[model samples]
Target: MPKANSALSRRAFLTSSAAGLAAFSSIIAFRANAQAAAGELLMVPAAPNPHGAIERLFLLHGDPLAGPIRKIVTESGNPVPAPTMESGARRVLRLMHFNDMHNHITDMHDKRGDTHRMSQIVRRMQETRAAAAENEVVLLLGGGDDHTGSVFDELLGWEPEEFVADAGYRVNSAAGVDVAVLGNHEFDRGAEMLRLGIEKDARFPLLSANVHSSAHIARDRDYTSAAVAEVKGMRIGFIGLTTQVDTRIGQPDDPDMGVASPVEAVRNVLPALSQVCDVVVILSHCGYGTGQSRSGKAGADRMIGEGDFDIAAAAGPLTDKPVVLIGGHSHTRLNAEGLNPDNVIDGVLMTQAEANGKYLGEITMSLAADQGRTGWFTHVGLHPIKSRDDRVAADDPKFDTFEKEDDYDAAFEEAHVAPLRLALQSKLAEAIGTVTAGDAVSTATVEAERYVGENALLNFMNDALVKRSAGFANGTVDLALFNATAILSGVAQGPLSFGDWYDVMPYADQVHIATMTGAQIHDMLQSNAKRIVRPEEADALDFSGFISRGFLHFSDGLRYRLVLGDAVADARAEDITLHGQPLDSMSERQFRVAFNSYVRLGGFSEAWNGKAIGAGVPGQIQGMDLRGLEYEESGLVYRNEIIAQIRQDGGISADAATLDGRLTVA
Candidate 1:
C-alpha cells in the first residue's frame, strides 16, 4: 500500500514462493495475493507432522504466539487441506490481553471513601483466567506501561538496567504475562532497568523483534527482543513496537530506543517463525491505522482485513489488524470499531479497558490447524472484579476486603532488594499541602476535577489561577478549564494532601500561558462543551475531547451562552458574559490562560486550536511535578464544577463514560 515493497514483486504475487530452506522442515511459503491490491503475506507449514517439522515461519516482534486461536483442527494427517481451513470446524479462541497496569496494586481512597480500581482489575484478570485457564491455551500479555516504583520491581534509586522479574505480582497470577513489549512510560525508568526486569523478574518471554539493540541482529544479543512459544503445540510468534513520540517529549537520558517499520517487522519475522509455528500473530505496540492509518487494509476485516501482516493494535491505533490485536496507550476503552460487536466494527472485536486497571479485555480467537493459517479474533471487555458500592455488595473475598488496613503498602513495606521508596517518600512522594472548599477535607486524597456532584476541586483550580494572577497585567482568565478525562476520582470537599494531588493529576505537566484571541477562545469553549455535554454511548469513559481540558473538565466560565439541542451542524451560542457581566460580540481581546503542558499541544485524540501566549510560574509545590497536576487553579481546591452545577440544574448532563454524540442542550 505504501508503494508495494520491492520484495513483493508481481512475480512474487502470482506464483508460489519457493519453500526455500523450509520445505524439508515441512513448511511451505504460500505467496498468496490478498484480495486487496496489496497482499496478505501468510506463511504456514506445507504439511502437519506428528513431530511438527515445518520451515518458513513468520514471527512478529512483541507477541508470543500472536494468538489465543481455537484449534481449527488438531494436528491431523499429512495433507494440510489447501492452505485454508473449513469454517464448520472453527471454535472461539478466548484470550485476555491488557497493558499499562504500571504495577499498580492496591486501593486508592477518594470521595467514594475507597476506590479499589487496581484490585478490581486483578480480580477480573484472575476470574477470566479461572474461567478459561484450562482452555487449549490462554495468553496474558502486556503492552508495557510498567511505571517505576510500582507493585513489582520497585525502582527507587538504583537504575532499572539492574533488575528483572516482578516478584510480588507473580504469586497472584495462576500464570503471569506470557509476553510484553515497550511503552513510552517504560522509558521513564530507562531501558537498562526494563532489560533487567525482563531478564530476571519475568516468568514468561518478552518479545520485541522490530526493535534491535544495534544494526542488524547478530547471534548472542543480550536484549530479550522477541519470542515464539507453543500453544498446545501451535507455534505462535510475537513482536513488539513502541511510540516514537518519545523522542520529542523526553530528556536524552531516557531509554534510547528505536523501532523498525512495524509493517516491515512483520514481513521480516513472520516468514521465519511461520516455518515452525502453525499461526503467526503480531502483538503490535504500534499505533493502529492498520494500513488504514495509511489508508489501506491488509489484515482480515475492513479495519484489519488481509494484509502483508496479520497484526493486532497493541496500543490504541486508528487502524486494526486482521489477526489478534490488543490495544493499549491513550487508555481509552475498546469501543472504537473492531472490538465490541454490540456497536460493531464488522463485529471485528477488540477492547480498551479504562486506565488505572478499571477493566480487562478478554478475547476469543478461532483458528483451524487443518485450515493451515486462517483465523479470526474477537474482543470482549470482561466485567471488572469490583467492590460493593452503596448499592451493591462485593461478591468475592478479593473485592469484599481491601488489604489497605495497614498504614503502608505491603508491596513496598517488605521489599528486600532496596528501600528506595520510603527513602524518597518525603522528597519525591511527600505531602506538603492541602486542598478544600471551606474546611479541611482529605489530607491524603486531593480532588482534581470534581466530576462528582459538588466540585471543590474544579472550583479550587480555576479560582486558584485567577487568584494567582490577580494583579497581573493580562489579569486572570475567565476560567481554568480542565478535561474531565484526567480526573481519577473525587476527594470529599476538604483538605488535600500531597498524595491526594498525585493520585488526581499524576503527570509532570506544568502550567502554561496562552494568548488566544476572543474568537479562538470562544471556538475552544464551544468545542469544549461539545466534548463534555455532548450525547455519548452508555457506560463508557468520556473522550479526552481528542484534546485536553482548557477550562477545567466541562467547567468553562461562560464568556457567551452556548445553545445546542440538535445535530453537529445545528449548534450555536449567544448571550455572552464574562465575570457575570454582559459582553459584546465584536470585542477582540487576548486572554491569559492557565493550561497543562501536555494539553498545550494536541493530546491523544484531543486537539484544541488555541494559540499559546507565554510561560507562567513553574512549580510543583510540595514535590509535585508541574505536569502531574491537571486543571490546577492557584487557589485551594480544584475540580470540573460546571458538570456538577449543570447536572443539578437538570440539563447538560452526560455520563463521564465514553464520549460520543449523545448530549443535548437544555
Candidate 2:
C-alpha cells in the first residue's frame, strides 16, 4: 500500500492494457457524419424506467465484449456523438471519482469488496488512455461521507483522534485520491476531533470553502477552504462545501464551526481560484436536487426552498470557468440523464457515484477554446464497479439471506485492510443468542411484507424499541416507530452474531421519547401512507418502497387496520389502539411516544404540517418537553440496544404460526 501523501504519479498507478482498450472500442462503433455536430451515444439495457438505464461504459476481464451492447434502441437507447474535440485534440484530464462511501471498508451485499476494485477500474481507464497515446491527466476524487456506516466505522468511535486516519483516509490514500471534500459525516464525532484527526492527516487536500470555525478550532488546525492542483500542465482549482443539514441531523451542536451557503461560498472563492487555475471544480457534499421541495425545477431558484444547497443550480451561475461539480450527501445515482437541462445549468456537468462504493463517476475533459474559455467536458460516465457478469441472481439462496459470505477481494483484504476486518469480525461475531427453528426471518421477507403491511423482522424490531423505551421511561412510553429503510438487511436462522445485528441495524441514531397528540400520530400515519407504493403500482420483485416510504412500523402493542385506496391520505386507519385501549384524538389528549431521533426531529414530515419538526421549525419537540413532561436521553445507541434486547429475550425467531397483525392493509 502507498504511504499517505506519497507523490505517486498517475502513470505508476495506471498501466496500459490492450484488452481494456479493445473493450472500449467494441462498445462504440461510430458511423461517418458529414455534419460536424457533436454526437452522443447512450447504450443501456432495456429497462422499464429511465433511471434504471446503464449510463456508464464498463470494461470486464475474460469477456471483453460482455454486457448489454446493442444498436441504438429508440425507446431504451440513444447514440449521439460525444462533444467533438478537433481531430487532433488531446485528452487533458480523466477524473475517476466516487462519493458517500460511508465507511464500507469491506464489501458486503451489493458493494464490490474493497477500494481495490475501484482502483482496478481506474487502472483500466488509464490503460485505455495510454493505448490511445493521449496526454491524459488522471486524477481520483471523493465527494465525502467517507466515514460512518458499517461495523468498522462504529468500532472506530472508540478511537476519536485516529478515526479518519485509521479508516477512510487510509483507504482513500491507498486508492490515490488526488482531492476530496469534507462531508457532513466528517463532523459526526465533532469539529474538534475532525480537525485533529482527518483534516490533519489527509494526504491530499481536503477542501471545504464554506466551512469555518467561529472559535478558530478548525481555522487554526489549517483546514483550507480551497486548494489548487496542477495535473499535466492544466491548473485545476478545487473548492469544497459540506451540506448545512449537518446542523440539524447528526452529532451534537458545535458552537464553533459554521457552514455557509454553498452558492455564496463558491462565489466567494471563484475569483481567487480563477486568477490562478485554468479549470475550477467544486467538491460538494450539498447533493444534486431541486431543493427540499419535491417540485422539479431548473436553475439556482430551485435551491431556495430546499434546506441543503443544490450544487448545479447554485454553482452554475457563479462562474463560467469550465467548472464541474462532484457531489454527494443524497446518495443519488447520476449519469448522462443527470446532465440534462432540467438538472444542471449549461456548461456545468455534475456527477455522483451512488453510495457504498457500488459505482464510479468518470469524466473526461479537454482544453478547448469555448467562447474564450479554456476548459469543457468531453465525456462523462457513471460506471458500476461490478461487472455485468458479477450479478447475483434473484433466486440465489443467498440473495436476501444474511449469512457469512466470501470476502469480495480476498487478496486486497489480506494485504491492506485485513487486521481491521479481523478485529470487527471477532468482536461482532459474538453469539448474542440463538433463534429457534422456523422463527428466523430474512431481510427479503421483511421488506416484501413491510410495504403492504406488517413483517416479522420489523415487528420484532419495533417491539424491541417499545420494550427498551418503556424501561427507560419507567413504563410511560406508549408506542415506538421506525422507518423501514432503517432496517438495512435481515438475519438468517440459527445462532445470531452481533455482526448479523450490525447488518440489520447499522446506523447510529439515538433514541428519543416525545409526546404527540393521538390526532398528530394519526396525521403522521396519514402522511406516511401517502408515500407508500401499492403492490399493483410497483414491480412484483421491486424493493424501492421499503426505502422510499412504507408506513412507519409501530410496537406490537399498537395495532391498526389500514384500508388501502386510490387516495392514500384518505385511507382509513381504523380501530387504532394502544395496549388494547382505544386511543384519543389530538384534540382530546396527548400520548407519550418513543422513536429514533430522526422522527423526533421531523425527518419525513412536510413543512406545512403542524406535526413537522426540524432545526428551524417552531413547536419542535425539545428534550421531550410536552405538557410539562420532562425529556430524557436514553444514552443508549439504537443498534446496541437492539442487540442487548435480543440477548435479554434469549433469542428472536419469526413466528411461523402467527402474524402480529399490527398493521392490516386491504
Candidate 3:
C-alpha cells in the first residue's frame, strides 16, 4: 500500500517552484512536488521511441524487433498477428475497449495504481488514434460505470444544485471516446447528473438500449439507444445495454427511469442497426459472466442481470453481420494475460477490461465480405500501465517503457482536473473534528472488526445516525441500523477530517426514520443473522455468502445476540434489547428506527443457483409506516448527518466504541 500525502503540506506546496508554475499547469507541478515530498512512485520510461508515430505506444513491451507486442493464440494454435494492413480484408478496424473506470482520474495509490493510470490510458489511446493508417481506423469504446468510487465523486457533487464540475467526464471527452454504455453506478449521483455529463462534458454519444428515462432531457438528443460510426466508408453500428438489476433500486433522481431486459433490448435494436451497418457492436454494462469465473472455477455466474454470454447467444441468430460485444459491470478481466477463450460466446466476439482503468482491452480484427461478411479476430489482449515495482520485478531492458503521464495528458489534467484536485486536497486535509474515541480507532482495526462483531467505529457511525436523526424525530428514535458492507474504508485516529469519514462511507445514501413495531424489528434482526459469518469463516465462504450484503450493525442502545447454526437456515437472532429492555417484552410497542435509504427500500436480496440463500430485509415489514419530516430530503444524506453530529459533539468520545456485550455472535 502507498502512503497518504501525510508529510506534504499545502502551504509549502503553494510556495514551491512547481507551485510557481501553477498559472501554466498546476496539475503537472503538483504531481512533481507531491511525488518528491511524499516519496510516491516515480515512473521510469524504458527509452524514447525512435520510430515516432509509426509504432504503437506501450508502457510495457518486450523486444521491439522480435516481439514488442504481447501475443494471444486462437483455438487453431496460431499467434495473433500485430496490426498490419491485410489486402485480403475489405475493412480493417482496431477496437479498444475498457470498462468500470469508476472515476479514478489520477494515479491510484494501492495495488490498483500498479496497473491503472488514467493519464497512461489517455496517452496510449491518443497514440493509437494518431498512428491509424489511411485504410485502417481505430475506435475507443467505454463499457460503462464512468462514475463513482473515489473522492472525485464526492468533490464533484451529484445533483444539479450541488455540482462542482464534470471533471471525470471531461477527461473522458479529451480521451476521445466514441461511445459509452450506461453502467449502474452512473445512477449513483442521480439521473440529472448523468444528463449533465452527457449534455456538458461528453464529446461522445452515450448509448443504452434498455434504460428509458422520463426526465426532462430529450431522448435521442441527450442520449440514444444506438449510434453508428462511419469509418473509412465502413458503417460500424453500436447498441448499448445496461443491467436491469440496479435500475430497479429506485434512486431518488431516477424515479421515472426504468430498465428492461438486456437480451430483449439488444434483440429489438439489432434488426434496425443491421439493416444499414456492416458490423454490430453491443456496448454492454450487463456483465461478462459465463462458463467459468475469473478464478477458473466453474459456473462463475454474475450475481446481477443476464450476462453478455446470454445476450450473445440470443442476439447472434438475429444478426447476419459479425457481432462484437464490449462489456462492463462484473469488472471481469477478459484478457488479463491474453485473450481468454471463454469470452467468445456463440459466434459473437467479446471483450471486457477489468474495472478502475487497470488495463485497456484491445481487439484487432478485420471484416471481409469474401465469405458473407466474416470477422477475423487477428489479436486480442490488454495494455497494462506498469508501476515502478512492476518494472523492477521484471528487470528486462529490451522492453521500452513510457511515462505514466505524458505531456499531452498532463496538459489535459492541468486544464481539467487540477483545480478540483487542489480544492478536494485542501478540504479533505482540514481537520473537521478530532477522533477522541478509545485510543483513536485505526483503519486496520475497522477492517479487522467490521465483519466479526460490534466495534467502536461501527458504534460511532450508527451512533452518529441515531443522534442526528433523533434531533429531527418528533419522538425518541429507538436505534439506528446499517449493513456492515456500507463501510467501504476505515477512519484513522486523532484529528479527523471530512476525507477520513468520507473514505468510511462515500455513498450518497439518505438517512430515514421508519416506524416499526417490536415484532417487525425482530424480523429485520433475525434476517441479519443469516448473513453474519465469523471472521474466520469469511474467507472460506462460497460465492453466495460473499455476495450477501445483509450483515448488519446496530446503533448504540440496541443489543442482539447472533447465534450460528449448522446452516444459514438455522441461524437466528435472539436476546434482542433496546435501552436494556428485552424487545420481545414490548412486542406491540411502535419503535422509531433510523437507518439509511438502502434499508428502507429493501433490495439486498441475493440468489445463487436460482435460489435465495441470504435473508434480506423483507420488503413488507409488518405494521411498518415510514413517516418522518425531512427524512427523505436530499439534504439529509447520511454523510451530512454524520458530519453535523461530529461538528456538534466537537469529537467522538473514548467510550463511543465501548462494547458492553451490545452485540454478541456465537
Q: For each candidate, what TM-score against the reference? A: 0.49, 0.69, 0.76
Model 1 lDDT tens row, 1-666 = 012224434453223223312232353223433111111222222211111112222222122223321122112212222232122333234556666565554333333344443444444444554554221345666665655323233332234443434432332231345566665555443355445544444444444554544232211132333454443333455555554432113222332335445545544444434444444444545443332122111111111112222233221132122344455544545553334443233222334443445555666565544554334434455545343233234675454443232322233234431243343245333333332233212322223112211244443444445554554444555545554445444444434344544455544334445555556555554554443223332123222222222223422344444464464333444565555554345258655566654454333223332222101101211111123222323321122222223223332112222122112234
Superposition-based RMSD of candidate 1 using all C-alpha atoms, in angstroms: 14.6
Worst 10 residues of 3 by lDDT: 56-65
Candidate whose TM-score is highest: 3
- Give the poorly placed runs of model 1, Cα more than 4 Å off: 1-97, 108-140, 147-178, 183-234, 241-276, 284-323, 329-355, 358-413, 416-456, 466-481, 529-560, 565-592, 609-666
Residues 578-633 of candidate 3 have per-residue lDDT tens digits of 88899999888887777676555554323211234322212222221222212434
Q: In model 3, which regions exceed 4 Å deviation? A: 1-89, 107-116, 216-218, 252-254, 290-302, 370-375, 387-408, 436-441, 473-476, 534-537, 541-546, 604-634, 649-654
Q: Specify the highest-lDDT model's number.
A: 3
Error of 2 at 164 (Å): 9.4
Model 2: lDDT equals: 0.55
Supply candidate 3's per-residue lDDT for 415: 65
**If both were scored by TM-score, which would come out higher, candidate 2 or candidate 3?**
3
Q: Candidate 2 at 514: error in angstroms? A: 2.2
